[model samples]
Target: MSSRTYPAWFHRVRSLVQDRKARGQAFRYNDDELPTRPQDYDEDLSERPNDSGDSDQSSILSDISGNASSEKARYYAMKEQRNERKKQLRDRRTGQGSNQSDDEWSEETEVQKELEIEEEEIRPIKEALTEAQQSPEENSAPLKKLGGRLFRLWSTDHVKYCTFETAPKRYIEFYDPKEFRGFKTYPDGKIDGHIYMVSDDMCEIDNFTPPKNPSLNFVRLDGNGVCHCFEVQFFDNHHLTLKMPKDLVFHRQAISPPSEAPEVFTYYGICEKYSDKLYRAKQRKEAQGK
Candidate 1:
C-alpha cells in the first residue's frame, strides 16, 4: 500500500524519512542491504522520483518486456514485493531498521548491556555463596564459665537475676548446689571459687553484667546474725539460710544475735525501686528545667 493509506506507524516512518530528506539529514534504517547515509538517500529516492510523471511513457514500452500470460514470472514478482514489506515490518518490530542509527540504538542497547552486566556481577557472588554452603561449620569458641556471681530477683515465679550493674537482667539460680555446677563469685566472695553476690532487681536481660563488691562480709552490717551472701541454702522450708561460708547465719527480719549484725547489702541481699528507670529520668528532667 502507499504511504498515505498505510498504518499510523508506517506513516510516522514515512514522515521521518521525508523530514530527513528536507533537512539534509542522514538516513539510518533502510531495507536495502547496502549501507546508506544522508547523501545516499537522495540517490535512492531519485531512482523512484516522479514515477507517475513517466508512467505513460514507461507503459508504452512495457509491452516488449514480458508476455501477458507469463503467470509464473508475474506471481514471483508480486511475491517479492510482499516479502520485502513483511521483512521491513518485522525489522521495525525487532528494532532492526537501518533508520535506527547507532546513536539511537545505543540507548536501546544500553538496557540490554546493563542486564548483561548485572548477570555477570551476580555470578561471582553466587559462586562464593555456593562455596560457603559446601564448607563445614566454622570453628567457634567453647563456652566456659567466666567466673561471675549470680543472684535471683525478688521472691516471684519469674526467673531473673541481677549482675552487679545498676539493674538486673540475668536468669541465674544455684544449680541445686549439689548439682556440682559451682557458682562464680565477686571480689570479696572470690575467695578460692565461691561468690557473695546479691540480687538487686530484675529488668530486661542483656549482657550478663557482673556486680561490684557485694561480699557477705561488709563493714556496714556484717553481723553474727544472718550472713548476707550471694547464694542461700534452703536449710528447710521455713529457714533458707546462708550456705556459702559453712559458719554463717542466713539472717531473716528477726535478728539472731543482738550485739552482732550480718551485712545488710550483699550479692545475696537486694534492694529494689518501685520503678526501675522512672525516678532517674524524672530527676534528670527536673535538673534540666532548673
Candidate 2:
C-alpha cells in the first residue's frame, strides 16, 4: 500500500480546522453551529432597515447616485489632466522648457513637424451662416461668404495627406463665422477638431512673394496654440481651393445647402450620415469590380 501525500496547503487547512475543533469552535463540518436561514429570506432586501436606520432602498439609491457623481468627477479630472499635458507639450515645443529628455524632445519635434505638414494639405469652401454673430459688416465679403457651409475634400495634390487618404470621408465646416471645424470618418474610428481662424498676411509657402491672384490668407489657432497659415487660392459658390506650404494644392466642393447654417452643429450626426454613404459607395465599387 502506498502512503497518500497531501499538498502543503491541505495540511495547513487541516491544522486550522483541528485547532478550531480543539477550542470547541465550529469548523467546516460543524453544520449544527451554522446559522439557519431566516423565514423572511425570500422577502425583498430593499424593504429591510440597514445599520444606519435607513431602508436598503435608500442605501442602494445613494450608492447609485454616488457612483454617477464619482464617474463625472473622474471624467472632468481626466480632461483637466489632458489639458495640462497639452500645455506642457506646447511650452516644451516653444523652447520654454528644457527638462525633457533628448528622445522625448525629438519625438515631440517630429509630431510638430507632422502637424505642420498636415495643415498645408487642407482646402476650403464658401458661404457664411452666423453673419450676425460675427457682425458681417466687419468682415470682407469673401470671408463672410465662406461661413455656414460644409466643404468636402474632392481631391488633393499630395497622395500621402494623412487626413484625406486615411479617412473614407472628410469635411471642413465653418460652423461659426470665425470658427472652423474639420472631421474625418474612418472605417472604425473618427477624428474631429475645431479652431479659431483669423486673417493673416504671412503665407507658409509663399512668404517671399505674394500670390499672383487675389488670395485670402488665414491663420488658424488650434487648442495647443499652434498657428497654421494657409492661403485661399480660389473660392466661389461651389468650389474652393487652397495653396499650402511645399506647393500642396487642395480642392474642395460645397456639399451642403448654400448660405444656410447646418441643421446639426455637432460632428456626430454628420459623420454618421457620411459613414453610411461611404459604406454604400464601397459596396457599389466592389459590386462593379465583380
Top candidate, metric lDDT: 2
Cα lDDT of model 1 overall?
0.30
lDDT measured at residue 277 in model 1 versus the true structure, 0 to 100 = 40
Question: Candidate 1 lDDT, tens digit per residue, 134-237?
Answer: 64423322222223323322221111111111111322332222233355332332212222223322111122222232222222212222333334322111
Per-residue CA lDDT of model 2 for 122-158, tens digit only, reads 3212222122235433243433233345544333223
The local distance difference test score of each candidate is 0.30, 0.32
Q: Locate the minimum summed-lDDT window of 10 residues in model 2.
A: 34-43
Give the range where candidate 1 is weakest over 10 consecutive residues by summed lDDT. 156-165
What are the TM-scores, per candidate, against the unseen true structure?
Answer: 0.16, 0.22
